[model samples]
Structure formats: C-alpha cells, structure tokens
Target: MGADPTAIVVGLGLPSDVGTGWLDDLTDGFRDECDLVGAGVAGGDTTRCDLVVISVTALGDLGGRAPVTRSGARPGDVVAVAGRLGHAAAGLALLESGHEGLPGPDGRRRDDPRRDDPRRDGRAEPYGSDERREDGVAGLVGAHRRPRPPYPCGPQAAALGATAMLDVSDGLLQDLGHVARASGVGIALDPGAFTVTPEMERVARLLAADPLDWVLTGGEDHALAATFPAEVRLPPAWTVVGRVTGGEGVQVSGRTVGQGGWDHFRM
Candidate 1:
C-alpha cells in the first residue's frame, strides 16, 4: 500500500543480457503491460544468469478498502469470473505442433517451418495455413505469451460487495480450490458458463483435447475470479459462473474435482 492508497509499487528483477536490446524490449514490455492496469515500477535489481528469469514484487493498494482474501467467501455468495479462459493452453498446442505462426515482437518476423523445415519436407503445420495474425489464432498466441489481466475488475468487484476475490493464475479450479479451502466453503461450478473462444475450440479439435479441461486446468490466463453477494448486481465485466455451496471442496456440475491445482513442489 502507498500513501496515495491507490498507487502500487512494483519491483522487477531482470537477467543480465549480453546485448542491451533484450533488456530494452523487456523494459518497454514491463512498462506497457504494467501501465495497461495502472501500475508503475518503483525500482529493482538486475543480474547475469544463463537464461531470463524475472522476479517481480508488487505491493497493491486497496484505496482504504478492506482487502479481499481467499477466506471471505460464504456459502450463499455467487461465483463469478471476469474475461475469457482456456486460450493460453490452446496457444501452447499451436506452438508445439510447428503451427508456431506467432509473429516476433511487434509483428515483424514470420517463419513458415513447414516450408523450411528440412525434416518435414514442406509438410504443413498441424493446423492448416491460417497462422496469419488476421486468422484469429493471434489472440490465443498473444494471450499465452503476454497475459493482460482484468486489473480494474478487482477493485470494481470489491466495490460491488464481493465477498471474496483472487486472480486466476493457476488453473481456475485450482485457484478456486484455494478460496474454498481458505473460506471453509464449497464451490460449485457450471461448465456451461465458461467463455470458450473459437480459437480454443479449433485448437482443441486439432489436439483431441477437451476445451473444458483447458478452462478448468489451464493456467496463466490472469483473469479475476470472485464471489459476490448473491443479491448484488454484478457489473458488466463480471460473469456469474457458479455459486458458493455447503461442502468442503469444489464440485463442477455434479462431480467433486480432485486435488488438481498446480503445485511447484510436486511438479
């Protein structure tokens, strides 16, 4: 928290680069991405490393509002999520199958590995020829590499009488599980309520993957998930995906979700 109550201080740690260009690009991205949600970098340190490893510390201000935590949810609150989900995992599928039509920074570089890969001999990428930016895959690709969080929605939900809130960094169910465990309440999710984009569906078909799995298990979407009072009218940015219920864990539809959240130590 800052003296201004709305200002946040961010500290960034960057790997040392042999060339100044990568550092410059990272700095610009940090500035632009942070500013996208009204955050500013205070200061930090840089050091040499074998690969780029960035550690960021953010001190957020709640503008004098009580902090919304995982423990605030209640059995009668309505569950909600802001923004889309599942595209990041789909984008990973495209990149892995040589459909990596993702353009280089600022849309300058384009590589057709199908036409150039000596091993494949002109075999097209797994997903057919539409890697171009206009083909709609760009949304998934960009979101995976550079996530845009629904920053304003956090405070907005808080103001709207939300009972609990958290960022969906890990898989949705996994993060929601945290809230459920912390609040000592159970969560019931409606799979039908998730917003599945066309690109996500397309990639899911190609990979023989379930888009619902991605929506539930995919990480890095950075969407805000919260529980508001059942009677409070959520703002336009919020989507009620489920409800708080009596139980000790999360259940989607009628099935209990196993302990499937991300764990770095276990992985």
Candidate 2:
C-alpha cells in the first residue's frame, strides 16, 4: 500500500559473544536510515541467539487518503515503476563473481597476477578503468549495499489515483503477480519499456546473463510499481511499463512469465 512510514520496531537476536561496538554500529545504521525519512526507532527487543537474526516492523500513516491496494487494480490501468530495477542484482552478481577481488581499473581490492596477464586460457577478459567508470559498476555496488526506494513516490502515486501499488522488493514479475491475483486482473508488460542501465548490461555481458533477467526476476531493488488510470499524467520519476487487462495473471509481450522471486521460506 502507498503509506508513509512513521516508525520502526526492531527485533534483534544476537550471539552472546558479540561486542557492544558491533551492536552500536548496527543500531546506528538503522537510526541513520530512519532519520532520512523522518521516522524513528520506537522500541525493540533483543535476545541471545546462535546467529544474528533481525525482524523489523514498520508503522506508517496514510494521511487522510484511502490506502492504495493491490485489489484496486482494474482493466485498462497503466502499470508503472518508480526508482531502480536491476542495479542491486547486477551488483550482487559482480560481488559473487569475485570481480571485487580483481585489481587495476576494476577498483577491486586484491592484487592478482592475472591482472597483468588479462587472459585465462586465451580468452579475452574485459577489464579497465574507463569501462568501469562508463559502466558504473561501483555505483551498482553501492546500490546493493543500500537500496534507495522512492519512499515519497508512494504517497505521490496514491495522490495520483493509483489503483494498485507496491514496492518491488521481490522480482518485478513476482510482486506484480500479487497485484494481478489480488485484483483479478491481468498485467501485460512491455519488454522495451524497462530501463536497463549500462552497468547492468556490462555485468550481464561478463556473466553471459540476460540483463532483462535481472530486471524481471532479480529482487531487492525495492522500486515502487503501481497501476494508474490511463488518463493520469505520471511524474518524471515513474515510467510506464505495462497495462492491466480484464483477466488473471501477468504476461510480457503476450507470453506468460513465471513468478520467480525471493521466497524467504524457500530460502
């Protein structure tokens, strides 16, 4: 729903060996982010555990407006997204690939002999500072470290008469499936509509992965996706990606796509 967050309550489970300094740093991070949104840490509980565990409950205010819900989407509504899409996933891929350890223009930390040789088994490996800057891999890494969801856009969508709204914490397709199911309407996405950054494209090339896969199926970007009336003039932050139809399920360019995304239980 499109609501403004007001407060957060944290539940922390930490091992007994953890130091006070570590705890302070953890709490400080939460406070810093909450302060950015004018929210505060209301209260929380802590306990000893085998591993660190965290649970957060966020409270929000809808102002005087009715909450925008997934069930409100109807046929003919325009589906749009605000904020990023695949940056986090691409960043994670870079980290997982051990690219962060490569030296030189890559900005990776480690010094490897391979850095001078550049070739493993006669295959050309892509590396260099100019390419890194142009692709903006560093920025992608930062995006993963701290996802910047368009918080204010939530209320903006609500004010603009968004029929259905949700933050795309999971993959876009999976989260949109929730709206499709709840509203009993179908959503058809345009493959050409999504914006894939150069950094994402570069990462995909290095990994031999489709950038669209990251955009459509990768999770944790936390971009806001909403459905608005066709007549609504969305702000510059929102990009129209799809449309609602009089059916059930989500599709892209006339083909049905799987609702594959982050599932905490499955994980």
Candidate 3:
C-alpha cells in the first residue's frame, strides 16, 4: 500500500514556500502530528528545466475533536494575538533600500565618537550599540523572508474557552475587521497598547515612515489572533490588543479603520 493521494494534495497546498527548504521544515515540523501522507517533486525537460513543481497532501484523524472555522467569532470577546508584528514589513523596506543595518533613533551613528575632535565633548553617547542594531535588522529580515506561526497558540485558545480565532495574514486592522464582520460586531484597538519594538522603530525612522503605521498596516505576520471572554485569563504570550463590540464594523480609536489586506489584484 502507498500514501493517500488526497493527503499529498493537501500538503502541497499548505501555506508555505513550495520548492524551498521551507517545505522540508514544514514537513519535519508536522512529523509527529500525522504521517507525511504523500510528497512529490518534479522538474525537467529534454533541454533544460526552468521550473520546479512540488505536490503534497496531508490527512489526519480528528481523534474525536470538533472542527473550527472562520465564522465562529462572537461579540463581547476580547481580541488578542500571539506573535510579533511589523518586522516583515520593516525587513522588506531595508532589503529594497539596500540598507545594511537596522533602523534606529534619529541622529544616531554606528561608530563611537572621536575623542580628539574639537567639536566633540569627548563624552560617550549612551545610545544603543552596534550589536543591538544588527540583531534588529537580522530579525526583521528573517520575519520578511519567513514568518513563524504560533501553531500551538490556536489550539491553546480553543482549549482556553475562546469564542473565535484567526491567523493574522493581513494587516492587524484588516484581519480584525474580518472577525468583526463575521461576528456581527465592531472592534476598537488602542494605539498606545501597540508598541513598536526598538528595531522596528529604527527601520521606520530610516524609511521616514511612521512606526504606528508599520505596526497597524503590516501583513504576513502569521500570528494567531483570537477572541476570548473578557474575564478569561489570557496566556502570557498573548497580547490583548482590542475588544469586540456589538456594533457592525471595526474601528481604531473611534475612527473607522480601513481594510488593507493582501490583495494580489490591487498589487
């Protein structure tokens, strides 16, 4: 007997890089959950193979569990997320602009001050070090190229009596809008609650972009966004970014937030 064809098809359709090493990582990552099911890669022609194609499928037993879907959200739930934001967007900006280091506060320089310069006070500046900037840039680049999803977070939310859940593939505002529309509710996000990490703030400054915009508008984060009871004890990793209301749409700071999700057509 061989692996099931349906399983192979499903695996290939999973949301990850197709031919890249990411596929292997994904396979290995899910090794314990279900058997690989099936996998195949094909490439080549009589002359030269210009393209590679891979097909995979996966199948799993429910183990007597209920299924979940996008329409399960409800009003009065506390909206939360598990994962970092804006790193990928900041990384893409750095890569496109050919910037070598992470973004930083205005007027800061990488090298230490020269001691003997007449214009210098000869005092060491107490700003961030080079290592911190480098780490920030590297993290942003990794986020852009490959986002790590909180796979366990979703299951944990369900187990913790969550009313709804979703993956943040679009901008935070846009994904929240989906939940709001689905649950027949509205959402309000606190701008102050969303903090930009140091590296992201630097990148935003370098690009002359607003750090808040980057945090709200960035997509491809792959973080798990979920809604739980207002009184529920949220996990430490989860951040309570917003709240669901009984209204019909979504808002940020009392203003109607726009939907700017991933749209290949618009691009």
Candidate 4:
C-alpha cells in the first residue's frame, strides 16, 4: 500500500502528421503524474499507427504490503466512490452532439453577448453547437480531452484498509460488476446516493436522458471505486453508495441492470 512508484514504460502510436505535440503532452503528463506519486521516467518508444494509443506500464515498490485486489471484497463490505461520477460521459455527450456553450463552472449556461439566449430566461433552449468545444466553456470539454484523477487517494485508501480497489476507467456499475464477479458477491447500488451535479441534470434535460443512467454507466472519469469493511470509517475522499452481499452480479435499487458499461471488443 505504501509502494514507491518505479518506471513507466509508455508506448505511443500516432499519425506522423500529428507530430510531437501528443508525445510531448504525454511526456509532460506522465512526468506530472510520476512526480505526484514519487515515480520517475524510465524509457519509452513511439511509432506511427492508424490511431493514437498510449500504453503505460506502471511498476512500483509496495513497501512490503500486500496488494489490494478485487477478490478481497467480502459480502459485508461497503461500496464507495472517491469523487463525483458521470462527468466524463456527460462531457463526451456534449462533444459528440457538438454541444457548445456548455455549463460554466457554476453549472449555468455560459452567458454570451447574444443577449437573447433563452436559457438565460429559464427556457430549455435547443443544444448542439460547436461553441461548447471552444475555449470559452472548458469544464466539460476539458474532462473529455484530459482526465484529472485523484492519485494520492489510492495510497490513502490502501492505508485506510480498503479491501478492494480499482479506477473507474469504465462505467461505475460495469466496473463494480467486475468486483462482484471476482469476489463472488453481489453489489446493491443506491442511485440516490450519488451527487447529481447540475451539469448532469442540464445534459439530461438537453438530451432527454436519465441522469442516473449516465452516472451509473458513463465511463472515463478515472475516479476510484473501492470496497471496505463495514466498520471502516471512510475519509472524506469517499462516499458510500452501496454494499456487498451474498449473490452474483450487480443490482441498482433492488432491480437487476440488464445491461451496463462498454466493451472495447464490441459496443
């Protein structure tokens, strides 16, 4: 749990025309991350490929503590999340739908000089514009373009007796399902436990979608979701949302989720 990070072997695939900007960004990004986690750059390689791909292999020294793995979760463990969920999915939706004028930092439509913006007058103005991707509204697009995961939280959770842990690189329910399957347990998720940010609600209204669905199934936020013993007092970094039980698979609000999350093999 108190592992000191070692080298990071990164493999980059990209189009030659795209140049070194991505590589530079990757270098700087990994440097920042390594610095935060007490790691150093070892070496890496770059190659031209059809699409940009980054494979980061992180090696570390655990300082003699056993690794916290998914299989350790027990029936009585409490499920928790380290931070707000569903932000990345909402941001991607905005980008995919070409939504501009995204909710500002305050979760309100960015007030533009257009003056006649209907949302300003409390109307459900039609969404989908290129402007949201512009520099003016950076919150959503920023998440889509780059992720800011709480790295230090991992060690904290580990030291605090987290039984099982993983990054929310995929959707919450989808990732939790992995824990359930590996631990041979069931997870009961309470959607009401999540913090429904105004941006999620705004996106839901704009797309006529369910905010809970996004929160449960949206991916790429990189927040940590872990399981701890029932008696553990989780720090402020985490909030309880569910619990493990004797069963298989996962359920939300007492109903089985017929489908959840994304598969790289097939959408």
Each candidate's clash count: 0, 0, 11, 2
Question: Which of the two, 2 or 3, has more lDDT?
Answer: 2
Give the per-residue Cα lDDT of candidate 4 at 201.
Answer: 79
The candidate that achieves the highest lDDT relative to the unseen native structure:
2
Candidate 2 lDDT tens digits, 103-173: 32456654332332212223322222223332366656656665667778988899999999988888898
**In candidate 3, residue 225 scores what lDDT?**
77
* Alpha carbon deviation, residue 131, candidate 3 (Å): 14
TM-score of 2: 0.84
Q: State the lDDT of candidate 3 residue by residue for 149-241, as single tens digits.
A: 555565577767777777777777777778777777888777777758877776777788677766676887677778888989997878998
TM-score of 4: 0.79
- Evaluate model 3: give its TM-score: 0.66
> Candidate 3 vs candidate 4: which has greater lDDT?
4
What is the TM-score of each predicted model, taking all chains together? 0.80, 0.84, 0.66, 0.79
How well does candidate 1 match the true structure, expressed as C-alpha RMSD? Answer: 8.4
Where does candidate 1 have its weakest 10-residue lDDT segment? 121-130
Screening candidate 2 with a backbone cut-off below 3 angstroms (N, C-alpha, C), the clashing residue pairs are none
Per-residue lDDT, model 4, residue 47, is 90
- Candidate 2 at 77: error in angstroms? 0.4
